[model samples]
Target: MSRKIAWIAAGGLAATLTACPARTPSLPNTPAPIHVPPGCEKNQTGEYHHAENPAFLYFGEDDGGTLTLGVARAREGLEGPGDAGTTVNIVLQRTPDGFVGETRSTTFTPSGTACPVRFPTEATACDDKGLTLRSVAATSIDENCRPAPTGPNPQWKEQRLVRGAPDAGASDAG
Candidate 1:
């Protein structure tokens, strides 16, 4: 009968629709691994020094400051179960002269493409008198230029402030 035919057609259409697989949304461009120059190695440590402001030194707790740099092992291509690569996060107070006070957190990734590690220079602070503080020197760790990871997690290695401005010299040497 017409009813039977209609039911059969509806069932066939429903079955066909269910048989098709769902499509997944395309993912955005993932960044490649950051490059690590010679002397820079995995788990290596260092400090982000202020050229002029000695108080604004980025080092570990043992270095007389609170801010400490941390790193984690990341799989190639930045794929991993936890924090990928060497992540560098800084926990310091923002000051008119530069980052002062306690260093809240910092991570450094020693591989892959360049990523922004932190706000190295500040116009108001470092650019004072037209002279930039400039990240004079850093320890021999792979400092990747990428955004720091977030969340209430723990797996980062604490970095100590080995040296700072007036002593730590100047250069982007991690």
Candidate 2:
């Protein structure tokens, strides 16, 4: 009787283990879809070339529907050693008319002095052809990293970017 009871208990334990398999770890929630305005429905994910310069802008969607624009400029070593080029990161949130956000710029000088500045920006008239972006802020920090009073004119001038091919280095699978 004791042996039969032991066998029965072992069989029940095996059945329970088989019935409830180990649960896999849960994945993170997916990001919510970005709500774009009527005219802004066109795909804006690509690389843009400056109208007159060799600079390029890469526009892509980040997590949570935020748009990230990366600015890459053509710099030659002739500028001298330790002369790091300027880096600009622009984050834009979708709005009714277009995208509104700020532009953060950091210029690295040969002397290793870093001047970081920010400006309020707006992007409008985004289409399959190009995008119009303007900096609405009037104040900008100077090279000495002091808040300099800008004149009536805006600090960062407006720029028009013409659409170009998507960057080949970026993975499309994502």
Candidate 3:
């Protein structure tokens, strides 16, 4: 009887071990953050807001040798001829390095004027990740209904806009 009891107990232990599979390590609650390039910070990746201005910048996939970006502002309202909201399509051609490029801004005003803005000495940099873009209040109008950099360049000028949150994956505007 004792031997039979021992045998049954051993078999039950084996069965119990086999009945329950090994436990796996629990997964984390949130996914890991995205990756970013070195020396790069975040720019206008998604929705951006300051005190009085709201802006958006979208960087699309590279098409051939050109890069496309959608720049939009929805807060400023003009009286004569413009949408309360406006979007500027930006097309850029890269130089040798990935840092420098030529940008052409094309926008149609509310007055039905198609304007292309370019300068002889134009340079586009995503340097330091457009740290000052958030400071812009969108005071871009003078007496004339034109785009004006009324604020300081370093404080209000648009620069490299990224595609992720500033803390998570602040990457290049690819």
Candidate 4:
């Protein structure tokens, strides 16, 4: 019967379509690979110092493409007497411009006040020289003693940090 033939044709078309493999959709654009700079390479970890600002950046392990670090921005001459430095914790991802990431900074005031503040930070690796660190902070402090999220737009600050030498006065005993 023609009705049976029509059904058979439809069934055959369905079978053929299911038998064909589906094509995968390709990405329109692929991101370029990240460039790792010297002193920030895998397994290269240590403390770097910013002489002018009296800050310190301690680099942790560069495992799995992520770099964790601690930043200590000394406030010896920048803040009131008895004020310590500002410390920032950063987790940076490898980027085309070295490493970029967010930071949480805590400024220690002379009155023992400290609070977490969010900000953006960047770092660039150099050829056996040091790292160029760029960071931004709100100029004002909130009532809660935290760094305010207001100021000259970004207030970007930069510093060049070199490898710190071992302290001669430090004792080996724990």
RMSD of each: 18.6, 11.9, 17.4, 7.2
Top TM-score hit: 4
Top-lDDT candidate index: 2
TM-score of each: 0.22, 0.55, 0.32, 0.58
TM-score computed on alpha carbons, candidate 4 = 0.58
Residue-level error in angstroms, candidate 1, position 2: 8.5
lDDT by residue (tens digit), candidate 3, 1-174: 999999999999999999999999998798444332333223323332222222443444444444455544432343542333444444444434432333345455566666655322112434333322212323333334466656444323444354433333332231
lDDT of 3 at 47: 33
Q: Candidate 2 lDDT, tens digit per residue, 1-174? A: 999999999999999999997999999997656455444556566677665453454555544345678876543344532224666778878755457788888754446678787788877667777777788545545557766566455657777777885444432221
Deviation (Å) of 46 in candidate 1: 7.1
Order the candidates by lDDT, highest first — what do you get?
2, 4, 3, 1
Q: Where does candidate 4 stray beyond 4 Å?
A: 1-32, 35-43, 53-59, 72-87, 96-98, 108-113, 144-150, 166-174
Candidate 4 lDDT over residue span 72-133, tens digit each: 54333355422254556777778776678877766644566676677787776543655666
Report the C-alpha lDDT of model 1 over 24-56, residue by residue, as the tens digit.
998998855433222222222244443333333
Clashing pairs in 4: none
